[model samples]
Target: MGTAERINSSQRTLPYVEIMDSTLRDGEQTNGVSFLPHEKLMVARMLLHDVNVDRIEVASARVSEGEKEAVRMICRYADQIGKLDRVEVLGFVDGHLSVDWITDCGGKVINLLAKGSLKHCTHQLQKTPENHIADIKETVEYATSKGLSVNLYLEDWSNGMKDSPEYVYQLMDELSSVSTIKRFMLPDTLGVMNPLQVIEYFRKMIKRYPDIHFDFHAHNDYDLAVSNSLAAVLSGAKGLHVTVNGLGERCGNAPMASVQAILKDQFHAKTGIVEDQLNGISRLVEGYSGIAVAPNQPIVGENVFTQVAGVHADGDTKDKLYYNELIPERFGRKREYALGKNSGKANIAKNLEELGLELTPEQTKRVTQRITELGDKKEIVTQEDLPYIVSDVLKHDAPEDKVKLISYVVSTAYGLKPGANIKVEINGQQYDGSAVGDGQYDAFVKALRYIYKKYLNRTFPILANYQVSIPPGGRTDALVQTVITWHYNDGLLRTRGLDADQTEAAIKATFKMLNIVESNL
Candidate 1:
């Protein structure tokens, strides 16, 4: 088929496309990312059971004992859940070596790798297309004989179609008759193809091999993986290969969350992905990979659902004018209105509603002004900080805090456990406590816990998370901001504090948390 003819042809709609996650295999190719065996098992279980992707490629055959162990563990878990066939491993066409390695690890499926382009066949593998085909057939035969289903990867398939269409055809023609080969995975190995090229090339492949199940694997070198993936689907590809948080070699692969979102929201296509679990899995992968997800990244980013402008917040109240099909609730997240220089009264009102606080028009104006001033100075104000901002703005109207910090002294010496002495007032009753701990912050928390438990006969909230940050530019004298998350009454509460010292900032945040708890009581 010619390019124009293929491009102009009627587009086909797929009711559903299979999702094959390669976070453990191809995603591990990302530099400085190596999941421990247990971590690999956790990710696999989550992908297969919780997120419920159609398939998972767990590891490459024979990489290391560690890789082998990870694959084995994943396979065992999958088998226990009756999902053994959904777990696949990448293997080479080296006769029976790759196949044997996979079968030894209890893998039920092998995705066989083969050279797709004439350049790769002749230069990289130093073999003609005929030689490469023979190796692949041998491996497929062996893998089938061992009772394992097989899929074939056309490595560098994008360049193969562009530079050597004849070679690609010859290989496909030879392998199309292999009943044992379940799927043909076409990869843009160098991340070179644009969406237009993808549509053109994919149409040709689908037209020539109508009976074949083709899975498109994309890379993000040009930041076009998601677009190319959509194009491939629109052009009739039956499956897609993706990684969590786009973790792969070089730039990365198409991220699972993004691909799923676009498929559902843009194309109106269906998949097995559990949309609500996308954010949780993304965070899990981010923690394991030590690669941070950008705050502005779509769907799973920290700020994607936050409205930063006053007009946007106003529009939201007027009928959700700024909302789209990608609602945060679909992915287990909530929309937030940011309080900053650009945030007008609408944003403040929205935040106040979330906190269950109602204020007079004039009181809200004062609070908005204070927030804007803080924002102009580049200070971050979260929804958790709104109550404090309101209390400060309308001091006479605000009630006295039920809890307050009187004093605290934390000390650390080279060879001794850190010690803390603390005095606090709760409902006007003063209490003193002292304790030793592994660190200064730990000591301080221990002292507070001692006071709460011994004097007040109360259970302290569990410290769920703590984060500290300073202004950019590596300024040593910059003020520190501490944010702490606490688990109280079967829910989570967050508080923020700012100070010149890190410990002091954390202590301030702790006091805020205590007051919040006391107020509820």
Candidate 2:
């Protein structure tokens, strides 16, 4: 039987691993990440209602008044929806201060942070094990009186397990008797534990306290957060702590998408997460956190589902031989075949199929070779570039000339704005325009736009992004490749040019864009 089937058949008996997302709380610990009160509320709603994560940690107690307001806003909305239990806030073991702060904000749950390592307990808090236990007990009792559910976070539990097992055991043994404690949360605070260590240590905790509920939280200091989280689950952890986009302090935490994928695909464990919403939430978090997700980042990254190699595309075309169980469709994404130097005829054919165009074998070979040549020059050959590339390689001249640059002059002076004068032939008529701008390229584009608007009585495409690069370790005079992306009515169009001067290269790319947009019109 499949893992899901096996787990489902024994549904009531199998352990259901609950996911607690801490993007707003721990994730905000990322350097330079601070969410406004309204942003925090919006994220909480999305995580709870849209993504359907089991729980969400929204903020820490007593951090700031802004944090208080954010927590209150999230709590108010959560209360209205009968999901108040699903929202949690991190608290400290500081008597009733954190508890009182949470209570004032209408929070129903508190994830109380306690020192797990012997060094932390002795040096950081300057308290004996007996005193620390007494403090935690007092806080739990006070929180329970306020009708708040409590979960304990054993901070630095991984290091504690390794360096001071007796103290960790003493702490757990003491806290396990508290009836108000809903879960005993263990965190690899320093991210020092590996998969094997996680399995062994987590299993030891489970065996010793078989009746206690455990939630495993991981850090990515060593890039093993996801692996350690999976190990925890396999060793009988009933809950996991996660952050969207893996945003956290230092190296961050295990990413939610990766953890979800591993749980479902590898372990057959079920979660409340809606797989399709993963990408949407990831993007949302990426924006709010100001952390750019790596293009190769698993599941939600831009290039994860894209095939860049021709052989891989050919294999996928045949029988999906290059496909993995982590299909892009599972996350509301599509598989894309990239066009570049490595793209063979099969890759060209795939792109052609998408564009609803077909070419003979000879045409295909020529187009592929041209694309390879462009790629060798470190220029990206996007699918939108295919028509121009085909026209260039096939030597199709007459129809391709919609707008052509006749002559242009650019000047720059110290402490003065750059200026440009451009002459262009559009539809076989010459138009001249001059403009001053922030830079030479900007000035050139401004002149082009002026000619299009005033002379031709037509609007031009908006320049969306412009990137320039030269081969690494090249001389100062090496060819500079400029790729310009333009937002047109149809879609985004990218055109590339190569020249010794950066401004000239950008101008060349812009000219290509004008002609392409003219042809489309």
Candidate 3:
């Protein structure tokens, strides 16, 4: 058929998009990432109840003791709500191990992995394709007799389509003709298939067995997981396999957010996914899995929606020329303008809008220059530092240098209390105090609090966060940076202090806080 004919045929099948999420199983298999039992249960509920995934493969049978418990807990919760059939487990060709595991765990569906390619059947299993098919057939028969559904997985089917199409075709033909197999999972085991190939091969399969349900599974070896998944959907594949945050073996699986977004926006395909909860769910998965998502990762990434270029921010002000169909707000996030070397006046204006600040052209230019200089020195500029950038660049005579720490001393001996002495001047009024704290910086903050509370009779700002960063090749005293967050009536403000000593870093941040607070007077 031609492209239009395919499109017409696809549109007719658009109402039947299927999404099977294996984040709990395949995603948890990410090396060095393990989800706790409760986390496993939580992610399972989110994938089914919140994201509305059609089915979730919670775990692989015979993995480990913890995995068994995790699967058991998830099964119990799923079975409690009458949605037990929506959960599945990965089972092997070893007949009873998987069957009994599923029966004991209260699982209803088993995705049985069997040889699809001739190479796997002959080389890996050391058996002929027909004999291998017999084994899978018997396994399915046994499971069916036990009142369980079987989904057959043709592992490495992508390569089978290329090198051994006949073997793949024969296997599909056999399984399709079998009543025990409920679904056929076609996996690009190595993530080697391109969009055109996915379209072509999927067409071949659907034409041969239009009645058989095929679920397309993709990997990200070439970073084409989402594209291939979309192609599968467009080519009339009934189900698509995905993982949360694209977490899986090798490069990962197609991220559920990307697939859902593309389907809903481009193809007008509808999924039961609650689009708004994408961020929260992604974060929960990340925290439990201990996988750090890169900042530029699409959809659920931290910086995906942030505009870092000045021109983009400028366009955003005019008509949103920089905007794309991937709006962050649609996925429970807000757009932000990054402050950096590339951030021009427009970027500055965007930050000012958030901080409720308006500066003249000259002031804006000065602030922008200082930010660029900081960027040149390889500094990360966060929105919290904008006010200080403005104050430093504008340099409106320094405002009397109201807060000055004339002298401070901290000593950490072999076995002695960590004490700090600080002498600070606020508006030419100086106060000196000494205090001991749990740590050196804590001692300093305690003394400062004494001066601010007893002497000034004012409420000190609340510290919301504390972050410290060293250069790439870390050194204990090599210009350590301490960023402190303080909240006042206006809002929260972040101030950073860098120095060779950690205590000095805290002192610098304290000075910035004093200035920020005194500026209002």
Candidate 4:
């Protein structure tokens, strides 16, 4: 179990590593986070069916009645899908209590938690290692008698290896003989192991119990969960415990997406995960967990696939010189070229291609200059904003807007509905319309719709989606950017506007949408 042996072990073709996602159990432990029964059910379904993770630890037994109900719901769905065996619950070494709770909720697997470190066993539980082992054995025996398969979690196993190797060895030695324990999950419970230490310790465990399945559970106190996970696999660990979005108590656990990617790409290890579903499930968990995934998080992050440097975009255009094995498409995302001060012609061209627009070299230079100006002012620009940028920069050659908002006034009072009065000129004909609505924007849109429907007898486009974004720093004067999507004819159209007022930005975007629709007509 030395470095040379670890290196040699890694050189050999690695075995398929089973992935056990503990998002429901470990991830739910995040501060200020709680998942209701339905939320838990949805996340569990996505992990098992869509993401295709090998197993899911849904809950810790006896936590609460609500948790028990969530487990029941997940178990029912999993059973219907023939995935009941893949759902597991964390059970304590409390004999029949944890086991009966799980069986009553229809769970088939119990991940039995046992003390691994001498300090935890000696201080926390106030029991000798022998007493703790007996308790675990009793629990495992009871769980087996109840027809539930068992896995053992050597809690704080990393510290046990570092501080008391004999204690960990003795526990493993005693438990390895139990034919019913399907796996031994070793946790870096405090997020304290470096990669080299992980390799050293995991190799020792693998060397001692070569036949037993060892799953590495990593915490990210040192931001080394992914690295330590790789090291564990290199040291011949057979499985890994991860959580969606890396959610867990304190820092977090090894993220499912990152661990899976590294295991497959770096180690050439096989897993059952559906890579394309990784991003989707990350987003799903983010919504339900209310823990935002960092935009720069690997594989499933928002900005990981974005080409921010113009040189990278230039390289990408020429035979994909900047491409790597971590292609965005592998995770159901497409590469995006960001428009900013750093954007070069290549970046502009890449975004243009996606928008199905072609620009002359001179036009591209002007648009690039305009985007750079916006970037310098700390404004955000999206691909959907490109058309408007192009029109503004080349206004001399651009045709006049077919639909124009001459004037608008919106008012709201505490005792009454908001109202809007608008004057619009379409095709050289001016019209005035007024309407009251639930909000100022709604009233404005209704007024505009009244002009199109009553005065012109024309079908107004349906507003489909509206999103507003403000740059960071939270300054009151910070510019707001609004992007609106409209359903017009057989296709969808997007328009963007930027202004100091959010309502004004939305109105500008609405005007842009009207002009685009009118031009098409």
TM-score per model over all chains: 0.89, 0.79, 0.80, 0.84
Lowest lDDT sum, 10 consecutive residues, model 3, at 393-402
Error of 2 at 243 (Å): 1.2
Highest lDDT model number? 1
Of 1 and 3, the candidate ahead on TM-score is: 1
Instruction: List where candidate 1 sits over 4 angstroms from the true fold.
Output: 1-12, 395-400, 404-465, 472-474, 486-492, 500-504
Worst 10-residue stretch by lDDT in candidate 2? 6-15
User: Lowest-scoring 10 consecutive residues by lDDT in candidate 4?
Assistant: 467-476
Estimate, for each residue in 1-521, the C-alpha lDDT of model 4 and write its tens digit: 99676665775678888999999999999998899999999999999999999999999999999999999999999999999999999999886889999999999999999999999999999999999988988888889999999999999999999999999999999999999999999999999999999989987888889899899999999999999998888878888999999999999999999998888876678899999999989988888887888889999887899999899999998999999999988998778899999998899999888767899999999999999999988777877678778989988456678888889999999999999999999889999999999989999999998998999998989986576787545466778878887876655577788789888999999988887666656
Q: Model 2: per-residue lDDT, tens digit, 1-521?
A: 99667545644444678999999999999999999999898899999999999999999998999999999999999999999999999999999999999999999999999999898999999999999999999999999999899999999888899999999999998999888999999999989999999989988998999999999999999999999998888878999999999999999999999999988887778899999989989978887777889999999898899898899988988998899889988997777788889988888899888766789999999999988887888666777678867877888853556788889999999999999999999898999999999999999989988998998888888986676887444667788988887877755577888899899898888877777677666
Model 4 stretches with alpha carbons more than 4 Å out:
1-12, 397-468, 472-474, 477-480, 483-521
What C-alpha RMSD separates each model from the true structure? Answer: 3.8, 5.8, 5.6, 4.9
lDDT of each residue in 1-521, candidate 1, tens digit only:
88655544523345589999999999999999999999999999999999999999999998999999999999999999999999999999888898999999999999999998999999999998998999889889999999999999999999999999999999999999999999999999999999999999999999999999999999999999999999999889999999999999999999999999988876778899999999989989999998999999989998899999999999999989999999999998778888899999999999898778999999999999999999988778877788878878887555677888888889888899999999888899999999999889999999999998999888999997677888534376888889988887765677888889899999989888887777667
84, model 1: CA deviation in Å?
1.4
Cα-lDDT of candidate 3: 0.86
Candidate numbers, best TM-score first, in rank order? 1, 4, 3, 2
**What number of clashing residue pairs does each candidate have, in the order they appear?**
0, 0, 0, 0
Tens-place lDDT per residue, model 3, 300-386, is 887898898999999999888999888887887778888888999999899988877889998888899898888877787877678
lDDT minimum window of 10 residues, candidate 1 = 4-13
